[model samples]
Target: MNSRFRRRSLLNSSEDNDPMSVVSNLFDVAMVFAVALMVALVSRYNMTEMFSQEDFTMVKNPGKENMEIITKEGEKISRYTPSGNKDSSSGKGKRVGVAYELENGDIIYVPE
Candidate 1:
């Protein structure tokens, strides 16, 4: 046999019928799949953060005396403070109402 043919035959015989070669190729394919999945997940997370509605909506800032006041309907924002109290306390001092908490995790408050 020619030297070139002999060399090719020798090199090919080492791996041609080896089960380890198939396993190595499978492992390489699995690694590629895992890498692709990670890349996709990262891209999806970035896209969710970019397109989320929280970006468009305004967050309520810390207002007078721990009051969680928000005005949604009015274009021009207005703040109204009930006379005498300034610490913005809740409970019976919270609103113009008597609040009752029910057994089903619901709150019912009636204005005074």
Candidate 2:
């Protein structure tokens, strides 16, 4: 059986080892890689669009006098509630409240 199989293999090498097989496999791998890259790009765009309004900040080793509050929206950013200044005689003034206008033409007041 082994002798017959070897004889057939030697006689018909074209069926077992196609010259285009290597090229076809490489093309398949490239197509898969391109598809994966496309998927990753689309997901990244969706994630950025969905969480566009959401933002955050960090305060490292805040001083004892006061703390700062920061707000961000896209490229525009705003800071609120500045720290206390020792030179000022009145000291740090407390935050009474803040009124924000919504996109749907509504006002919301946030109190500290």
Best by lDDT: 2
Which residues of candidate 1, in runs, are more than 4 Å off? 1-12, 47-112
lDDT of each: 0.63, 0.72
Candidate 2: how many backbone clashes?
0
- Alpha-carbon RMSD to native, per candidate: 12.6, 10.9
Model 1 scores a TM of: 0.33
Q: Can you write out model 1's per-residue Cα lDDT over 8-52, one digit (the tens) per residue?
A: 888889668788989999999999999999879879755333333
TM-score of candidate 2 on Cα atoms, chains taken together: 0.34
**Which run of 10 residues does model 2 get worst, by summed lDDT?**
57-66
Candidate 2 deviant stretches above 4 angstroms: 1-12, 47-112
The weakest ten consecutive residues by lDDT in model 1 span 50-59
